[model samples]
Target: MSKRTTPVVAGEKAGSKRTKAEEPGIRILGPEEFAVLVADLLPTT
Candidate 1:
């Protein structure tokens, strides 16, 4: 049987302080804005 995994990474401790999307530093982009940011990552002919 496989062992269960955790959401915390090695450098990060569980239940540590985290930034929320509502915070001023965090910017929530719309679909159009997100698409523009990742457009270069998509494959092209």
Candidate 2:
């Protein structure tokens, strides 16, 4: 069986001054990463 790895999502901490979306410190997920996140949320039969 193959091993599955979980993707990491990085972002600003709570109560940070750079809470605005226009800030340059934001982290963006690619299409593959986004799909993996969605798959993890789905119910398994």
Candidate 3:
């Protein structure tokens, strides 16, 4: 298994800001990070 650092908080994007609707329990992830997360969720052989 790989090590995971403390997860990211909401609206932590490089140049993006938080929107009004995302105020409630929103967790924002970057493109690469999101891809990694998706890959991690896949089944491994």
- Which predicted model would earn the best lDDT? 3
Which candidate achieves the best TM-score against the true structure?
Answer: 2
Model 1 stretches astray by more than 4 angstroms: 1-20
Q: List the candidate 3 regions with Cα displacement exceeding 4 Å.
A: 1-18
Over 1-45, each residue of candidate 2 has an lDDT whose tens digit, in order, gives 112323334344533432332254454455677788889999999
lDDT of 1 by residue, 1-45 (tens): 112322212222312222333233334455566676678788887
Q: What is the C-alpha RMSD of each candidate to the true structure, in Å?
A: 12.2, 10.3, 9.7
Clashes of each: 0, 0, 0
Question: Each model's TM-score, in the order given?
Answer: 0.40, 0.44, 0.41
Candidate 1 has what TM-score?
0.40
Predicted candidate 3 versus true structure: per-residue lDDT over 1-45, tens digit per residue: 112323443335443334432445355576677778989999999
**Candidate 3's error at 18, in angstroms?**
4.5
Name the 10 consecutive residues with the lowest summed lDDT in model 2: 1-10
lDDT accuracy of residue 9 in candidate 3: 34
Sort all candidates by TM-score, best to worst.
2, 3, 1
lDDT of 2: 0.49
